[model samples]
Target: MSKISDVILRGVTGAFITNSGVGKIGMPAEHSAGLQQAAASGIPLMAKLPSDKFGTFIGYSEVGIGAALLAPFVPNKIAGAALTAFTGGLLSMYFRNPENTQADGIRPTQEGMPLAKDFFMLAIGLALMTQNEK
Candidate 1:
């Protein structure tokens, strides 16, 4: 059985991620292009994909991860692993972009605050994965 905290965490994160994914699935061409360009800085392979395709792919991936998190039947470890991997990619993108960081290279610039906040999600994912079942 999952704790109330776990349920709340999963519900909130799942809904947020799912909505973001849905939005991306129908993203404007310019939006997709910009996102692809930014992602390419960290994952060079992303540059090879067409902007529309990239957007759809990312959307579907997020939806799947969100569904996993939302499903009570899904194991916490499995859902956490997915979230961790996704957030890791996001963090990588944030760190790889010089424009997103400050002079210290570790802190976020004004533009990077949104991405930097993903660190909290990463921490939550780690906690979910490591927590023992009650």
Candidate 2:
């Protein structure tokens, strides 16, 4: 990747992850909807854990991913791989909940749109991670 592309990827993804991580860590109350959704989705551990703790764990993970992507010393591929995996998990959760979308299933309802948008991040991370491999 070109220097500009590298910077753009790192900067955009870093900013987004940092913002989300900070919110998740700092504001548990605001994420109640997500907790409820998680429970409804029937994910094993997510439904069992206390919402605050679960949010905190997710926050920490996002923070770690953001830090890795933002750090100059970290390899782009490594950061990209982590981001890809993380967003994939988010996508999985979205898909697991049919109610998140409308009749078509492709179009997202208000509840599911956020997770649906993660595809961009996944794609960007995959591109950056694989770009240098030839």
Candidate 3:
């Protein structure tokens, strides 16, 4: 594994841990409140946030820590090159064709996406997450 792969993996890990962790934490309360508020306001309450609040912690932490461990191994020459390339390709595909998510609507303050490795991989990982939902 080379230093570059470590860098990419760490970048990805850091991002996933932070944002996903926040959503995992804050979303449930907000979701409940939103649903209640929407019901009060006679609006359609789209409960995107489910009652099981802690489950996201497991997935986010697992992936973040997993990525951190994998980062160092990404430089391992045995399979580092191939893994990094695959991650890069997945990232590239997401960057090229980003699916504007409803989550983006929740917080409109975020800037446009960049060519950063983590976001690229996030697009890939997030896609995988969605796929796995089936």
Candidate 4:
């Protein structure tokens, strides 16, 4: 691996390690509500995962996302990146075109988290990926 690649991987992996680690040791604070909603969406599917397993799923998810985002940089990086992305995407799906509609130009960031660029990011990110790719 090139030094530059090493540095980039180091930075990305470190961030994944930190955030995912938090999900394991504590919780993915910024992403918790989304995940819970995701789990709640699929009652039977999520119910199979015990309460204690929430963090485990989250840990593997973060690792997966970390690995995916790092896939181009390092083969192993896909482990974390894809995992977290799957979790994030799973949660994001629920947010997309939410069951309850919002007024024009308004999006909610959880119950009381207020609305901001994060909504744009969430929507844009969703659009960028979900859009038809020919």
Give the count of colliding residue pairs in each prediction: 0, 0, 4, 23
RMSD of 2: 2.8
Measured with C-alpha atoms, the lDDT of residue 133 in candidate 3 is 17
lDDT by residue (tens digit), candidate 2, 1-134: 33778879987898899888877775565485476467447455566656656777777888899888888778789989999988877887778788777888767899999888998999988987887742
Q: Which residue pairs collide, candidate 3?
A: 1-75, 1-76, 1-77, 2-75
Ten contiguous residues minimizing lDDT sum, candidate 3:
106-115
lDDT tens digits by residue: candidate 4, 1-54? 234544454355546444754557445543555555555663435645655556
Candidate that would win on TM-score: 1
The reply for model 1, stretches above 4 Å from the true place, is none
**How well is each residue in 77-132 modelled by candidate 1, as lDDT tens digits?**
99899999999989999999888999999999999999999998898789889988
- TM-score per candidate: 0.93, 0.81, 0.30, 0.43
Ranking by TM-score: 1, 2, 4, 3
- What does the lDDT read for residue 73 in candidate 4? 48
lDDT of 1 at 54: 79
Q: Once all C-alphas are superposed, what RMSD does model 1 give against the true structure?
A: 1.3
Write down the worst ten-residue block by lDDT for model 1: 1-10
Clashing pairs in 1: none
C-alpha RMSD for every candidate? 1.3, 2.8, 11.0, 7.3
